[model samples]
Target: MATRAVWRYRAIFAMLCAAIVFFALLPFGAGEGGVPGPDLIVCLMAAWILRRPDYVPVWLLLIVLILADVLLMRPLGLWTLILILMSEYLRRRVDHTEALPFWSEAGLVAACITAAYLVDHLALVLLLAETPPVLGQGLHALATIVFYPATAVFSQVIGVRRLAPGELDSLGTRA
Candidate 1:
């Protein structure tokens, strides 16, 4: 039974990772009079989904980020690093907090997503001078903010539970 459960987790993890990559590739509109593309919600969802870092290994996260970079033709290692950083930040927040309500969690998710965008987009603009239209950036940010509730609803609807007892042995009760 333990073996089956382990395999089940592995399968689910793989599926979730694939969904992240696929969703990242989707041409979701950035709103009116904008690029009408580029979805950052996937990064937030990936971070939210992997609230348990153990379930989503660093290597696997790196691979998925790399795939996203290639699919989006973005600067290599940019999104990969952003995802890793956000995941680490979220994990640390989970460790420090004694209790977190739904709204707080949703807010953190939105903040992390916005942070990732600000860091990456600004860096890209400074380094490459790409300067994507201001309207597009505004639209994307708005879309991400709007996207948060849907992700929260999805997690709740899917009965997305957190780490099991023994799974957090390394981090102790705090985590």
Candidate 2:
């Protein structure tokens, strides 16, 4: 049962990611309009991982991140590496963060996203890659941070909420 549930949510995560990427890539003709939009995939990935780390296997995440880089034309492994690191970071802290108040958890999300964005930007700058101005990237990070709570709520609505202490063995018995 635990394995079944994990696979089900894993599929959901993939479908949702595909839809978001498709929608974002749609030719709305806006073409990088005045401001950059929030990185919704990153927000959703972070929220889901925080809630249920086991649902998102590392190999699965790598596949998705690489797809994002190729489809979204990001700096290949650069953003992928950053996101993988962020995911692992959150995964490791899941127990501690789950116990905190919602705002505190959201703050941590913001910090992680912000740091990821900053690191990504710095790497691009050092490589002399063409990137949008810092202001634009900052806006993107801000928008992503702002949307985190909504994604966290969405995660819960989709049954990926943080496991209460009582849920132990509800997932599966410990060895």
Candidate 3:
């Protein structure tokens, strides 16, 4: 029974990661202007991390973020590192943050996203790569922060509920 539950959870995690990558690669209409893409992938990742960290193990999160970096053609391991750290931070705080008001959670996400972007920007500057305009990065961060609530709702609808303390065994528990 535990083995079956573990497989189910792994399958769901894989599907969600694949969905994020697939949707990110899908082209929008030509009329769509601006930053070129929404950070929906990050939003979903953050949602899953905050809501159910056990389902999103550190190794799996690393694999997904690295895959995203390769797919999105950004600097290798840049976002992987940033998001892994962010997810770890959120995972540690999930117990407390889950009890806070929605807006407070949003604020937390916003701060993290902003920090990630800033780090990316600084990395680009240090590397002397031609970076996108700051305004566009700002807009992208805003979109990501704004999209968190929707992603959280979608995650919940898909049955990824926040696990209470001592609820690990409700599914196959993870270390």
- What's the distance in Å from true for residue 173, model 1? 7.2
The Cα error of candidate 3 at residue 34, in Å, is 2.5
Q: How well is each residue in 1-175 modelled by candidate 3, as lDDT tens digits?
A: 3456555765787777788788767775323455545588688878877777766778887887788889978889977898888988887778788679878988898899999999989989999998978887888888888888998899889877777666664345521
Q: How many residue pairs clash in all the candidates, one count each?
A: 0, 0, 0
Report how far residue 82 has shifted in candidate 1, in Å.
Answer: 1.4
lDDT of each: 0.61, 0.85, 0.78
TM-score of each: 0.73, 0.92, 0.85
Cα deviation of 44 in candidate 1 (Å)? 5.5
Q: Which ten residues in a row have the lowest lDDT in candidate 2?
A: 166-175
Q: Which pairs clash inside model 1?
A: none
* Candidate 2, 56-145: lDDT as tens digits: 878989998899889988778999999999999988888888668999989999999999999998898899999878888898899899
TM-score of structure candidate 1: 0.73
C-alpha RMSD of each candidate structure in angstroms: 4.0, 2.3, 2.8
Summarize candidate 1's per-residue lDDT along 76-174 as a digit string, tens digits: 887678878887777677654325676777777777777877887888877976766766666676677666766656644554456654554223432
Which model, 1 or 2, shows the larger TM-score? 2
Ranking by TM-score: 2, 3, 1
Pick by TM-score: 1 or 3, better one:
3
By TM-score, the best candidate is 2
